[model samples]
Target: MTSIGGAEMVDWNLAVATATRLVRPGPEVGRDEARAIVAELREHARSAEEHVRGYTRMFGEDADGAAAPHDTPVLVVDRPGWVRANVAGFRAVLTPLLEKMQERRSALPGGAVLGAVGGKVTGVELGMLLSFLATRVLGQYETFAPPSFDLPAGTSAGRLLLVAPNIVHVERELDVDPHDFRLWVCLHEETHRTQFTAVPWLRDHLESEIHAFLAETDVDPSTLLERLHEAGQSMTGGRASGEDGEGSAAESRSLVEVVQTPAQREILGRLTAVMSLLEGHADYVMDGVGPEVVPSVGEIREKFQQRRAKGAGRLDQALRRLLGLDAKLRQYRDGERFVRHVVDRVGMAGFNRVWTSPNTLPTKVEIAKPADWIARVHGDAGN
Candidate 1:
């Protein structure tokens, strides 16, 4: 219960508990509608799994002998439930960074006092961030552990979920066919499931990169201030040659971008390429499912794009921009275009080579330029 600046830095358990329920409550359902939604979800238990597997066969990998453990169950959840789920994911991803940060603070003169306050502030900031996201996301193919609250051995082995309330809300607001929208959302999420599970090395590849990124995130006040000052000058005037004349693009970047060291930046580049591929592949699959099967698919795409374009007010939009979430959205677009172009030229079988080994993965620049990737990959094969 130690604290700094009247805050604790590492109480994610408490932060998640407090913030999970603070999200906007979705429209209330009568008992009948509730039962219907649940029943439909339950009835189509493996609908996403089955459909995604079928679609991905066209990508050169099928469900057969796929490495993903089938024991991972898909669950349906409300907004508060989604918050609980995501906080657990954040916990797993951020734990390494948090541990390293706390250790550094504890090494200071008033290490004890600073550690508590810093942990508290960081936890609170993260909680507020999660709560805000809970109010926005419609569907997520969550793949981390369940919240610490749910484990007592063999209790909840879940890693997949649909934010049921948000789905219903968007369906209502858009006035599109409910069934079509639900299926479409499932297709997108299920694609994520297949990507991680089917490709054995992918999950660990991502985990390792995240660990590397977090390991490099040891920021001190003076260094950060200096970076901020240099970044400001870069934006207002001109990009400075790094004291090394490298003249990199680190100037005035987002939170995720500015924190990188050069080595970490290379790692980040690889990760960005991989994530773009995953997201882009998923987008490609979902769209490829086509409007013929899902009648309102076109309308949903149009309305969804409109929704993404509209800002949720100044504060929300500002937060997304600063946090690099805007870049995240760009990943989907950039990735989809990459996948589509690659498939068009080389076909799905050729693209499947990417999953054969991490070495074949595209860099960030190559994601935007498929021909470069094609030439390099084909040349390497020739060698």
Candidate 2:
């Protein structure tokens, strides 16, 4: 990979190439079949956006202060294309942090060569991770446009990305109605778009939290690798693998230790709460749209969940645990419960006040106990 300005931190091209190489070829669906699938998806894309936004309007406030723009064109891609796109997205997100880490590395011995090796390792690991993840993510609502993501010309700032092959795979495997499942997936992804666009502050808010997280931490390459290893186990109760270095010690520390400082806790806690809300709200809205809109809603929820819980090979399971994907799996249940509980006690209108300001967002404890959040926000009875 070529270095930029002689100080490249992530070697993004290497990451993309690595991911593309590692990605397994999909089942041999024919070109005509594939083309038909894309055509149908593309046709539904516009209506999916309208239906999703329409439902979102019924449930939450406009996040962007204006009508959420409809200009973000939907693009369909194969699994490898999805991997490259996400590698691009992660580059945009991770570059700043990598640069900060690079600055900290300048003080160490064996700077340039060490940095090159570090960049290579990081790029490879990132590629490996994205290759695995690309198959898993159904759709993504990309809020910020990074030039490197190479989004198509004339598309809007906010866009929805769909993995066409994955969509086809899931529909056939689940034996669910293809049209219904495709629309269902679109509804969920579009809700994500509406959430960020509705609350215009959300994108910047998440970016700022990321920036703070980067500023507060410093790590060498080996330690950073070790930490990524630990993040995989974080969802479970396993200890992160590490030895005596300061960064290693941080990795070895439990989630509590990592969030020990007020500043770190504030940042992590806010991120957790916000993600939970966004996810939960989207799940809630997806369901709220109901059986009328998606007749297989109940079945899709049930078998799709079973599909989610289906075990993989031993190594894949290990990777999922290490990735903290188990924790991500939990967010759906936890977030939806919080949203359901809140709306149950106060009704949707009162719950809408949560969007009024960041202060009203549920804390981790509050998510577990809706009555407490209700009382705090509305002086209703405490849990």
Candidate 3:
């Protein structure tokens, strides 16, 4: 099958097949019940956007001052469908970087031979990773999905995906009101859709940051091997102790952290800050819009937070740590605090200034210290 690097760097089809094969099945219900669940999720997804827009007061307008209608597509998909959409997104975004890496790999002696085998191996690894994630993600707003002819005229290509089975599974697990829980999930996902669609530059800005990060790749075989070794050590709890003599922090570094160069780390920091803002803002909006509409919102929030903290078994927890999912969990808490603080101090209008331009976006430090972001973005006006 065709791929970013002619199947030399990754076999996209193999990855999808592998993920679909390995992903655990979602919770089961009768055919009629399943149909009902999907229908309910779609209904909630459509209406959730109105609630999100009403609360956040954001319209899907471009930064160029060109007003566009909000017609972003919404798909209520099962686990395998979620996997396919994400694989497509990954392939699209990683295409340029993979092509560049392929060029570098081809220059090395015996590189062509290594690539043929490496492609299959990498594809399998990616599939395994996606399989793990496929079941966990309840919904997502795909920021980098390629342009589609199916989208309406003047509509952004971004698509919102709701993993119907997982949502049902979580609601069952949490034993919360199915209707309340479903709407709650949509509120968060729709907020993301609004964030990207409202601030048109956001999607492109994030894509550029990702491309910039990928462009800094060290494709040398030896460097790649070293990163693998570092990752192994990280996974095995082998990092050397720091001055504190505990080495806890070093041991806790994810595979994502072990593989990065200093340059990539700087970019990662910036990306992290941006993600923190997005996730936090969504979380804030969900809760902010919750009490008024979702009667069981308080219970859902309490139980969901507990579930996130509880996590899974030892192996799963270890994988989560290595995959940087733990860092992601922190992003929710930190980002929400940042948004809440800024909104509490300066109001939503002041917080909206962040979307004015990339320049107004918070730096990594400013995310942790909202006062600084307020001071910098709003100057004396914020005070």
Best by lDDT: 3
Q: What lDDT score is found at residue 376 in candidate 2?
A: 91
Indicate the TM-score of model 3. Answer: 0.88
Clashing pairs in 3: none
Q: Which regions of candidate 3 deviate over 4 angstroms?
A: 1-6, 60-69, 148-155, 219-255
Sorting all predicted structures by lDDT, with the top scorer first, yields 3, 2, 1
Ranking by TM-score: 3, 2, 1
> Tens-digit lDDT track for model 2 on 207-261?
7876786566544556666555454333234443432233343133442233235
* Most TM-score-accurate candidate: 3
How many collisions between residues are there in candidate 1?
A: 8
* TM-score of candidate 1 to 2 decimals: 0.82
TM-score of every candidate: 0.82, 0.83, 0.88
For model 1, name the residue pairs that clash: 3-116, 3-117, 4-116, 4-117, 8-119, 8-120, 9-119, 9-120
Candidate 2, lDDT over the whole model:
0.70
| Candidate 1 residue-wise lDDT, 83-107, digit = tens | 7777767766776765565555656
Q: Model 3, 1-383: lDDT tens per residue?
A: 23333445776788899889988998888999989988888888888877888888776456986445467888889889998889888887877767777787777777767777777766776777788789899999988776665454455558899998889899999999999999999999999998987887888899889888888867554444344344334334545224246644336566556557889999999999999999999999999999988999999999999999998765566567767898889999999999999999998877899999999999889999999999988899999
